[model samples]
Target: MASTDTNDIYWRAYFKAIKLQAGGGATEPGMGKEYFYIASNANRSIAASRFIPMATTNEYLYQEADNLMDPNAPLYVPGAGNTSYVQALYTYLRHVKRPRDTLTPEEEKAEKALTQKLKDAQATYRSERKSAMADWKEEKDFENLSFGAWAFKNARTFYAAWEALNTADGALQDFLASVYGADAQKYRSDMKKISGVANDILAPVPGLSMTCSNIPVLDVAEGIEKAKKGDRGPPVGEPVGYERPAYSLDPQYRDTMDRWAVEYDSTPSTGNAKVTWEQGSKTSWKEFGFENIEAGGGVTLFGFLRIGGHGGSHTEYENVKIDEKNSTVDIELKWKKLQFFNVYPGTWNIPQIRETYPEVVDLDEAQKLLIRPTQFLCASGLSITCKLGGQAKEEADRLYKKQVEAGGSAGVRWGLFGFDAGGGYKKEDGTQTSTSSYDTQKGELTISPTPTFGNCTLLGVRGQAVSI
Candidate 1:
C-alpha cells in the first residue's frame, strides 16, 4: 500500500489502524505492541499484537474450521476482539461464517460509511506516502511488476493437515476411498505419519524428480519475491519503467538505470528496518516493524482431491507469483499425471485401437522421463544403494513390487530413489537452530552486487544498454 492510496483493498483494511498509528486520525496513535483497535472494541491489544503475525496458521483458526468447508477461514469476525484484526489486515476477508449470510443492508451501509471515513482520513496521508515510495516497477526481485501478490505462505501445512484429517478419521478414509480411490490412501501415509515434521511448519518436502528445493523452495521463492519488490531495484539491468522525474544529460540520451535509491537487504529479524532511511517522514519508507513479513501462511485443502494414475491427482499450475498457497501443486514434481496410450507402428492401423497399440496400454510419461537419466549407466551392469530408515525400507519394498510388476528388471532396468525428506530428526536439546546472516554492511548503490551495480554505476547511470 502506498501513501498515494491507503484506500485500496489491503490498505483499506488496515488504513484506520495504520493511520491511527501514523497519527492522521483522531484517536491517539499506537507504537509497537501498544497498537490496538478502538477501546470500545475487543480491547485485547496485547494478544492481538502477538497473534496478528501468526494470523494464517494460528492453531485456533484451524480448530475453528469445522471440517474445512470454506476456503477463507470462517472464523474471522470483523470488529470483534481476537479475530477482527486479521480481517482488518487482510481486509478482503470480512468476518464471514457458514450460517452467516452476507452482511445485512445496515451492516453494508455501516461498512460503506466506515470506508468513506477511512478514505477521508487516508486522503491526508496519500501525498506523503507517494513521496516515501520509489518507482519500483523495474526492481529485479519483484515476481510480477504488479503490486498485488498472493504467495503460498505454508502450503505444506495444507497437505499435512489433510494427512492428519485422513489419518484421524476412518469415515474420511471411507470417503476418500469411495470418492477418490483406494490407492489415494497410499499417497498420504508418507505425508503425515512422520514424528518431527508432524508439527514442523518449515518441514522439508519430498524431492521428486529433477526438483530444486531450498529452505522450502516454495516459501523461499515468495520471500525472495517480496524482498525484491519491497526493496529498490539494482543500478543496472532493465530500462526505467516510468519516465524519470528529472533528467536530460541530453534530450537524445535516455537513462536506462534506476535513478531511485537502491534498497537494502531487509532479511533482518526486526523485519526491514530501512535504517538508511528513517520512517515517520515523507522522505523514507516506513519501518516494517515486525519479525515475520507475515509473508507465508497455510491453507485448508480438505474433501475429495482429484487423484492421479493408480490414484493421486494432477493439475498444471501457472502464475504462482500471484496465486494463493492452495493453488501451488506439483510445481516441482515433473511427474506426468497425464494418461496416453502406446502407439505401435505395426499395430497402428487397428481400427478399434485408433492407429495406436492393439491394446490401449496407458503409460506414465513421467515414468519414461524418470528412467532416461539412469538408463545407460544402469544398463552398463548392476547398481547398489545404501540408506537406513523405515521410510527407505518402505520405498524399497514398494519399488521392488513395482519393478517385479514391470517384469523383474527386463521391463524397467534402471531405478532411482530420492533421499529422505521431512527432516524430523530429534534435536539434541529439543530445539532447532539458525546460523544467522553473514551481515554485509556495505550498502548497494548500484544494481549489480559484484562491482556494486556494475557498469551502470560506473557510468553514473545510463538508459538502455542496447540504445547506447
Candidate 2:
C-alpha cells in the first residue's frame, strides 16, 4: 500500500508537469523546473524498465511526459505560427518592453520574413484594386459622356462623313484627333479611304467640296431625273426649262451644234482640281464654286442645303415647282420629333412600362430589371421589370396575404395578429413594396385601396407571436 501510494503521487506530479509545459495547465513559476531531472541514460533505462517487472505505472507516466517535452513530440497545431500569426505576434511585440526579453535569432529572422511577405501582399492588392477602380471609372465616364447633346451632335457628323464618303474626317474626327491624339488620326484616314475618298475627302457640311469628276454614274442618272421632273426649279416668272428645238435648222447650223454637243458630252473629271466657292445662297438651294461662275468648269455647284431642328414638331417639305410646266414630286429627307421618357424611382418592370410604352422598352433594360432583387433601391430614371414567373408569383402572394392580415387588425373583434411565412408581427413594407398583387380568395380579409386608377392604398395591423 505504501509503494502504490508513493507511485501514484509521482505519477500525478509527472503528468501535471507535462500538462503545464506541453498542454496549457496551472504551474508555479521557477518551482516547476525542479521536478524534471536530465539523465544521459534516461532513454535506455526507460526501454529496459518497460520489459522488466519494475516498469510501474508511475515510470510509464514519467517516460510519456519526457517524450512530450521533447521538441520532436508528435503533436499537431493547425497552421501553427504562420505568416499571419507571426505578423500578429510582431504587432503585439512592437508595444512590449524588450531590453532583456528580446526575440531569439530564429524568431527575429521569422519576423523579418513575415513582415516583408505581408508588405508585398498589401502592395499587390492595392495596385490591383487601384487599376480596377480606374478602369471602371473610365468606362462609367464614357457612358455618361455619350448621353450629352454635344456628344450626340458630334457623333452624328462623324458618322455622316463616314457614311457618305466611307471615311471619318468630319468635325467629330478632327475633335477626336485633337483630344485623343494620333491614334484617332489613323481611324479617320482609314474610314475616308474606305469611302472612295482617298484624296481630299469632303467633310459632310454645307460648303464641303466633292470633285464631281469620277462621281458614280448613279449620281448623273439622279441629276437627269431631277431635270426631267423639273424638281425645285426657279419661280414661275423666272425662265428655266428644257430648250425648244427648232425644226427648220440649216445643215451647216445643225453640224455646228453637233460639234458643240460632242465637245460637252464627256463627263468632267476632277483630279487635282482646286475647287473654291464663287457664291453661296441658302434660299435658292444653289452655291457656286471654282474659278469662273459664268463658264461651268470654274464654278463649284452645290444644291439643296438642309438644316435640322428639334422639339415635338417635325417638318417634311417638297419642292414641286420644276421648270414652268412639270411639277416635282415631294421627297422625305430630314425629320425630327421630341421623345419624352419618364424616370421611375426604381427599376420599374420593362414589361409593365412596355404595357404603357412598348416603343421604349428595349432588350437591355428588360433583362436588367427582371433579374435585380426588389430590396435594392435605384435612382430616378432607372427602370426595371421583374420577369413574370413562379418565384415572383409566390413572393407576391405571400406579401398580399401578409398585407391583408395587417389591415384586418382594426376590423377584427378579437384583435388577431398575423404571421408571415410562419405568421407573426410584421411591417407592411416588410411583405413587399412597389409591386402588384394577384389571385386571392375573395372576402378573406383582402386589403385594397378605395380609389382605383392603377393605384391603391390600404391600411393594416401587425401582430406578435406567442409560443405555447
Candidate 3:
C-alpha cells in the first residue's frame, strides 16, 4: 500500500467540504460514508459519486436516481424537499381525476343565478342611491323655486315695466331714455339678461313656468311714476293720509232752539264760566259775556285756531245769546279734536270676524301704540319742573293711565276686544268697523279713531284734517 492512508484522508476531507457547501448539518445525510462504500463497491470513481454522472445506456430510472443524488442538478432536492414532492404528486392526481372545465348542469345554473343576483343587487343599490340624491336636490330646488316665485310675484309690476322699456322702439322709447337717462336703458338690458339666465336654469324643473304669468302686475304708468319720484324705497316712515268722522256739537240747548251757553248775570261774577280749547301750549278761551242782547237772537262768531308746534288748524264756531231781563248771556261753541297714532303696514287677518264678517276686509293697522314718550318725569316741591304741552299731553297721559289700569293697549283699542261705534265689542256684532285704513297716495297704513260725542277733546291735532 503506497500511501493509502493519505488517499483515504484526502477523500474524507473532500466529502466534508462538499457537505459544508450544501448547507448540511453535521448529523444530516450529506456526502455520508455510505456514498463512498457504494461508489467503491460498484467500481465507480470517487469523482463520479460526488458528481453523480448520467447513465450512458437506456436506463431511465438509473439516470433519474443518479440525477437526484447530484447536488449540481437543476431538480435535485435535499431531505427537506420530500414534502414538496408529496404535494406535487397529490396535485397531479387531483387534476387527472377532475378537470377545471368540467361543471354539472345544476352547478352551471346555480353560478348563473348567483351572478344575476349580484348584478341585480348592484343595480338596485345604484338606483336607490341615485333616487335619494335626486330627492335631496329636488327638495332644495323646491324651496328656491318657492322663494323665486314670491319675489317675482311681488315685483311683477317692475318687471313688466322693464320688459316694456326693453321692447320700446319709437318715440316712446326715446322719450323714456331722455327722462330716465342712459342708466335706465342699461338696467333694462341687464334685467332681461338675468331673467333669461334664470329661465334657462329653471327649464329642467317641471311645473315652473318660463314667464311668471300668475303674478299680478302693476300699471306701467304707475310704475314709471313711482320710479321717477324715487318712491320705490321702503314704505316705512312715509306720511299717510287718513280721514275719520269727527264729532261736532250743535249750539243749541236741550228741547229749545236757543243756543246753549254759560250765562253771567253781572259784569264780574263770583265764578266766571270759561270754555277753553287747548292746542299744545296754546289755548283759546271764551268767557261768559255780560253784554245785553235781544231775546231769541244770538251772535255767531267764526274763527280759525292754529294748533301750535303741530301742523294744522281748525275752525271754531261759537254762538252767544244774552237775556237783559235776567242779566244773563248764553255761549255755545263747536270744535274738533284730533288724535295721533302710529301705524304699521301688514295684512291684519282677524280670526274672530273672518268667518262671520263680510265685505272682503283687510285692515292694515298699528302693531302697538307708543303710550309713554318719556318714562321719567321730574318734579319739585309744590310745583313741577316739567312744562307740559297743555291738553294734548294731559289727554295722552289720561288715556295711557286708563289703558294701564284696564290691562289693555294704550291710545285706541283694536282687534276682537275693541269697541265699535255702538260701544260694544267688535266680536259681539258680526259687523266690521274701519279701525285701520290704507293710504294709497302715501303708501302707508294709518289708524284714525272715529271721534264720538263723549270721547272728543281739544288737543294738539296733527295730520291732514278735513273739516266735517
Candidate 4:
C-alpha cells in the first residue's frame, strides 16, 4: 500500500515534469506562464516557487540517470500540505539564510535572526525526511554541490512560506516551519531518491554498450537537436545543396564549328565519326582512319577527320550491347584514339602526328601538374592496375546509400570512424612486403617487420584502436 501511494506520487511528479519539459497541457495557473492560463490559480506563488527549481533539479537528475535505465523511475511531487513545504523552501532560499549582495544593518539583523530559525527548521525537516525515505546515511551524505543545490532550490519555497507567515502577523516563520518544514525535508528526501532512481536507471548494465561514458557521444547531440526543434528527434548533419550555374554558349564560334562538323561527318566515314561538339548549327567532329594525308596510308586529320591506323595511331574498341532486342547480336563500338609519339618510326610523320595529338605542344617540360593522389597512383601503376581499394572505393557508394536512406537531408554520417589509424604498404623486393600504421593521439606506430627467410613472406597485421 505504501509502495502504491509512493508510485502514485511519483507518477504525478513525472507527468508534471513531462508537461513542463515538453511545454504542453493546461497547467494550474501560478506556476509561471505554464499555469498562467488557468483562472482560479490559488497556489501561484507557491507552485512557481516549488516547481521551478524542482524542474531544473529533475532535468539534471534525468541526464544523470539517462544512461542507467531503459524506463526511468518518477520523482516525488509534494501534495497540498507539501505545497506549503514548497513555500517554506523558497522562503529559505530567497529570503532567510539566502545569499545577499548588500544588507542594511536592520536587514542584516533580521537575516541573521531568520537564519537561525531556518537552520533549526532545516535540521528538523532533514531528520523527519530521513525517517520517511527509510534511508538515513545515503540522504545525509548528499551534501556540497548536490546537497547544496537541493537545499538552495527547496529553500526558495521555504523562504516564500516564511514571508507569508511573517506578513500575516502569525507566529508565522516559527509556526509555518513547525507545520511544514518536515514535509519540505520529505520533498527534498523524495527528490534525492528520484535522482538516485534516475542514476540507477542510467547506470550501465552488464555487457551493454549503454554506459555513462558512451551515451553522451550517441545521445547529447540528438537530445539537444530534439529540444531545439521542439521534438525528441535524432540529429541530421549539416544541410547541403547545389545551385547550377547559368549556361551560356559563345555565339561567335557557332558557324565555323558546325560547318566543320558536317564536312567531317560526310567525308568517307573515316575510322569512326562523332559530332564531338554540338551547338546550334555549328558542331565539332572527329574521324579516325589513315595516318598521313599527303604521304597516304598513315593516320592523318583534316578538320577533325583522321584516316589510317598505322603510324602513331592504334585501334582499340569495345562492343557494348546497345539494347535488349540485339543484346549480344548487335553491339555499338566504343573506342579511344591512342597516339604514341615515342614509338613512331620517322621524324617526318612527327609534325602531322603532333597535330593529331595536340598534347605534344607542352612549352615547359619541367612544369609539374597537380594530380589527385588516387588518379596519379592509378595512372602510374598501369601494369598492376593499382585502384583505390577500400575507403575511397566506398566513398561514392556510401554517399549514394546515405542519399537514398535520408531521401532529402537526414541520413548522413559525416565523420570518420574513431578507430581508424592511417596505413601504408611497401614492397622493396618483388616477393617481400611490409606494412606501417599510425595513430592520431599516440602519433606514430613503431612497427618493425623482419623477414623470417625473406622469400614469399606474406604478412597481414590487424588490430583495433580506440579514440577519446
Candidate 5:
C-alpha cells in the first residue's frame, strides 16, 4: 500500500486521468496513468474504482501445479500482474496491429480465420471454465460444509487435490484469480499460512474457518407468510442454519464426542457457542465514483467531481442461530443504517454546497458539515438480502411494490448496495457507502468496509473445531 499522502496523490491523478479521458480506454496518456500502472499492479485500484484497464489472458489454461501452488507464480497475482497478465496485454497489443496493418488478400483471409478462432476461443474458454469450476467444487465438497474440524483435518487433502489438477496442460488454473477477484493473493497468503504450500514437506498443518443466512426466494417468502400464521417448517423446509453449537465441546466433555469425528445425532460441537456484535458497528464515510459519469464524453464538470461520500454507516445484529438438521448457520442481521450530515458532495465547490445547503455561510461551515452528522439514523437497512436476488430479494421487491402499487419492477430501479452490480458510480458525497455486495451470478457475498470508517465492525458468525 502506498503512504497516505502518496495514495492521495496517486488516486487524485488516476481519477483526474480517467475523467480527462472518455473512459473504456484512456485518452490522456500523459496523466500519469501509465506511471501508476507500471508502478506494479499492487498499486492499481480495484475493478470498482480502477481507472486502469486490466489485461485478459488465457495462460491459466496452461499453468502447472507448481505455479498453481506457488504464491509467487500463481495464475493470477493482482499485485504482481504476474506472467499471464503480461501475455494477455501483449496478445491484445500484437493483434491490435491487424486493424491498421495493410495486408494481401490471402493474409486478410487468414487473419479473419485467426480472429474467428480467437473469438471462438473466448466463448469456449468461458464455457469450459464455468463447467470445470462447478464440477470441482461439487467433487470437493458437495455439501459446502462450513469450515471447522472437518476442514482443519482435510485441509491438506483439499489443497493436494486442487493443485494436482494443475498438470502440464494447466487448464485447472485458468482464470483462477477471477474466482476471488482482488482477494486472490490474500487468499493465497492465508491458505499458504494455513496448510503451507501444497506439496512442500516443510509446509505446516492448517489450524482451520460463514454463519450467514441465504434463503431461496420461495422458501424465504413462504417462511415469512408461515411466520405470520404460525404454520412454519415442513412442506416448506424449516429455516435451517448452522451456528456455533449452543454448547462448545469442552475438554471436560471429551467423552461425548464421537471418536470417528463424524456428524451424528450426538456429534459433539466444539469451539465457541455464540457470535455477536455487542455494540453497534459503524463506518466512516468512504467515497465512490460514477460510471464513465459521461460514458463516452470527457472533461466535463462531473470530471472535477471525483471523490464522493455515501455518508457514514452503522449496523446492529439482533440475532444469530444454527440448525443441525440443515447443516447451516443462520445470521439474522438487522438492517444496516447510514449516518451523515455535512455529507454534501465531496467534489462540490463552494457555490454547489451553498446552493445545496443555504444555511452554510462560508468555507468553515462547509468543512464542518463534511465531518459532522446532523442525522444519525438515515436510510433504512442497506438491502443486504434483497440485493442478492433470492427469496429474500423477491420478498423485498413485493414489499416495495406493495408500497408503490402493482406495476411490478417496471420503472422500478434498484438503488441498493453498489449500483449496477458492484459499482459504476463515483465516490462523491451524498452517495451511500458500499457496505455489502453480493454477486448473484457467482453466489458470492463480499463484505468490505471503507478505509475511512474506523468504527466500522464487520458482521459475521463462525466457529472452529478443536481437539476436545
Candidate 6:
C-alpha cells in the first residue's frame, strides 16, 4: 500500500544524521548548531517539496526570510528575492485556496495611489530634515564665532575705525564751513548722498592706499596722463616726484595684522588637544604651560590646544606666535586626531564527515565508525539530510505506483510522518532502537540522543589584525 512508513524511517534517519553531525550526541566543538539547523531546514524545504505546506517548514522559512532581511546578518543579501521568500510562500498558499491571476481595476488603482502617497511622504520628510539640519549647523557656527574673543576684538576694531572716520569727517566739515561757506554745505550734502558706496569701499582696510606722497595732486595727475600717452620723459627730481613716507607704525604691521585676523577667524570655537611629549630623564611638554613666556621678538612655539564644543570641538596642535610688529597673537591650526582605533577580521573552520550506506556496512556500523575519527562536528547537518530526502522521495514514488496498480485510493503526501507500529529495529541486547518519536497530527519531529565525546580531527583557523 502507498503508506508513509518508509518515508518516516528515512526522515528519522535524516534527523539522526543531522543531530549527530551537529554535536547533539558528541561533545565535539562545532559551528553554531542552531544556525546550521535553520540553514538546513531552508535548504531541505526548497529542495524536497519546493516549500510545500508544513507548519515546521513554514516556520523555518519565515525565520530564514527574517535573517536574510536583517542588515546585521553576515549572510544577508540585499534584494527582494532573498528577503521575500516567506511572503511569496504566503501568497502562493493564498492563491492555491482562492486562485486569481490579477487584481481588479479598482484594487489596482488603489494600490498605485497608495504606493505614490508613501513615496511622496518619504521624499518630503527627507528634504525637510536635510534643510533643517543645514540651517541648525549654520546658526550654531555663527553663535559660536560671535562669542569668541578674536571675533569680539575684530568687531571692536571695525567700529573704532568707523568712529574715527566720522570724527575726521566732522572736523573736515567745520573747516570747509569756515573756508568755503555755502559751497562746503553742498559738498557735505553730496558726500552724504554717496555714503552707502563709501561704506562698501571702506570695508576692506587691506585694499586701502596707505602710502603718502609729498607731490602735488595736479602734478601726480599730469604724470599719469603723460605715462598713458607713452611720452618718454626724464625722471622728475625731488619735489615733483612721489615717494612713500615713513609711517609711525612698524613696516610689517599691516601684513602681521592681516595674518592674525585670518588665523583667528579660521580657529574653531570647542575640544581637547592631544599632546605628545618626549621624556629623557627630564620634564616633558605636558608638564609645562605657557605662563611666563615673553609675547614678542619673533618667539614661536608648537603646542596642543582644544577648540569649539561637541560638533564644534577641534583637537590639534597649533603653531602659536606673538606678532610684535602688529602687537597681536597669531596661530595656525587644523582639526582632526593624530591617533585612531584598530580593527581586525578573523575566521574559524570545523571538519565534517559524510558517509553513505554503500560506503559502510550498516547504520549501526556507520554510527560506531563515525565516532572514532573527528573532533569538532560540522554543525550544518545538511550533507546527510539532503541525501536522505532524495532517497525518501524515490522510495515513496515506487510505493505509490505499486499501490495505484492495486486499485487503492491511497495517495502520497510529503509531510511529517511517524514509524509504523512494531516496525523499528532491535539492538544486540534485544531492545527496540528508534532515534525518537514523531506525531503527524501535531506535525512535530523529536529526536533525543545520548550525548557523548568522540575523537575527531581539528581544522585550520586564521585571522588578521589592522591598525587604524
lDDT of each: 0.20, 0.22, 0.22, 0.22, 0.23, 0.23
Q: Which pairs clash in model 3? A: 261-331
* lDDT over C-alpha atoms for residue 284 of model 4: 10
Candidate 6 lDDT, tens digit per residue, 1-468?
111222222222332323333332222332112211111111211100111112222232223222222111211121322323222222221112111234568755754565354345435534543453344334534323221222234445443444444444444334333343334454444333222222212221222211222211123223323433555255333211111111122233223222222232233422221111111112211111111121111112111110111112321211112122332211111121111111110011111212101121113321221011111121111111011123333333344344335433222111211111111212222111223322323322232211101100111001110000
Rank list by TM-score: 5, 4, 1, 3, 6, 2
- Model 2 residue 393 lDDT score: 35
- Candidate 6 is scored at a TM of 0.14
Q: What would the per-residue lDDT of candidate 3 be over residues 106-207, giving only the tens digit for each residue?
A: 755754565354345435534543454344334534324432343234434433433333333222223322333335564234233323232122121222
The deviation in Å at residue 437 for candidate 2 is 65
Model 4 residue 230 lDDT?
Answer: 48
Off by over 4 Å in 6: 1-3, 20-115, 119-468
Error of 4 at 426 (Å): 48
Residue-level lDDT of model 5, residues 419-454, one tens digit each, is 211232233321224444434353333333222110
Provide the TM-score for each candidate, comma-separated. 0.15, 0.12, 0.14, 0.16, 0.21, 0.14
Q: Identify the superior model by lDDT, candidate 2 or candidate 5.
A: 5
lDDT of 4 by residue, 252-271 (tens): 22222222222322333122
Q: In candidate 4, where is summed lDDT lowest over 10 consecutive residues?
A: 372-381
Model 3 residue runs over 4 Å out of place are 1-148, 151-162, 165-420, 428-468
Candidate 4 vs candidate 6: the lDDT winner is: 6
Q: What count of clashes does model 2 give?
A: 20
Off by over 4 Å in 2: 1-100, 140-468
lDDT of 1 by residue, 259-328 (tens): 1111223211121101110122131112221111112222121111110112124221111011112221
lDDT for model 5, please: 0.23
